[model samples]
Target: MSAAHVISILSSKKARTMTESSQAMEQWADKLEAVARRQDTQAFEALFNHFAPLIKAFALSSGLQRQGDHLPDELVQDVMLAIWRKAASYDRRKAAASTWIFTIARNQRIDTLRRLSKYQNDISADEIWDLEGDTELFGEIRQSRVQTQVRDQLKELPVDQRQVMAKVFLEDKSHQEVASEMGLPLGTVKSRVRLAMKKLKLSLEALDL
Candidate 1:
């Protein structure tokens, strides 16, 4: 095909390929990338555990709980699917994975809440993908451009700071929770998290979306 013809065909496809792939095994990463683009069942599950709570917290915080009829899980799943379907447009540079994921959750939650009063009846109990709750470790198979950037920025920080961050941030523990678990002083845990955030914020200063 002509380059222009190939480009046009790609433009019409539902899933977009990565702009840059790192290595040969990285072709495997392309599979999940395609899954994300296609929003396959597997990819959705992998993503859900990672970002579900963030969405749930966002929804509950936004007052979705007042809806007697809407299950928080339902709302979160809806938001997550929307994210999956829209994955093609994801700009990883502009937002952290959680931030982008939660933004979708937030928007979906808003949509669900919008119909709160209107949904006066019970919806079917289908097995909605628990996008926000399941914590499957779809190990970092291969780094995409975005994941690579994140890894590099993370590498720039001290090892101890990184350890604290992995616990408190990625592990979803609070400063106190991490502190108690690690047997560190509460203040020390808080300081570590604060410092971690400062480092990340600085490293990511160029992009804030």
Candidate 2:
């Protein structure tokens, strides 16, 4: 075949692929909308059949398998439940059905991690700020002074680091929870928290407290 003819064939294939993709997206959206508009179990079942395997793969890739073989199943259940309950909130214009559903899966994974971490040796705010060293000195006067100093130091941190520190320490959220809520990768959230803590530690040391 001539090069131009071959190029035309490739272009036709690409267009067909795009059209098929758009149709598939629209079909998913229609199914989800049916479930939303009415308690359509069949439509919901269709969604489940389409999304469950994909979600399972995502869960395994996200390290859920390390926790337990059953955890991925649990995550899938949670994501589907959220879809059922929150179907009415979905807007196709804002996100495709797959995008919306996977976001829920991601958040559910974070929540699962938070639940699992609770049973582990989770760090406390006092530990993060090194207040465990001097029990006597951590009394009311010293506690108040340290709190004021820490607040001041927190204000000096970069915005991203400060937000992560606030969510993880002040709000008592797990790193995974902070990551999901902030729309950041888990690693980025952890790195920000670590950087924030390091800065706080340096500031506290300079204060000799």
Q: All candidates: CA RMSD in angstroms?
A: 14.5, 18.0
Q: Tell me the whole-model lDDT of each prediction, alpha carbons only.
A: 0.57, 0.72
Give the C-alpha lDDT of model 2: 0.72
Q: What is the per-residue lDDT of model 1 for residues 171-209, given as tens digits with 9 covering 90 to 100?
A: 435788888888899998877766776765534345653
lDDT of 2 at 135: 37
Q: Which stretches of candidate 1 lie over 4 Å from their true place?
A: 1-32, 37-39, 117-209
What digit string (tens of lDDT, one per residue) describes model 2 on residues 1-209?
89999999999986786567667877988999999999699999999999998888877765677878899888888889878988997766556666567667766666677677747445433234331223342243443334345645777899989877766753436899888888999999988877887776644345654
Give model 1 RMSD, 1 decimal: 14.5
Give residue 5's error in model 2 in angstroms: 2.2
Residue 53 alpha-carbon offset, candidate 2, angstroms: 1.1
Native-to-model Cα distance after best TM-score fit, residue 19 in candidate 1, in Å: 23
Q: What is residue 70's positional error in candidate 1, in angstroms?
A: 3.0
TM-scores of the candidates in the order shown:
0.39, 0.56
Give the TM-score (vs. native) of candidate 1.
Answer: 0.39
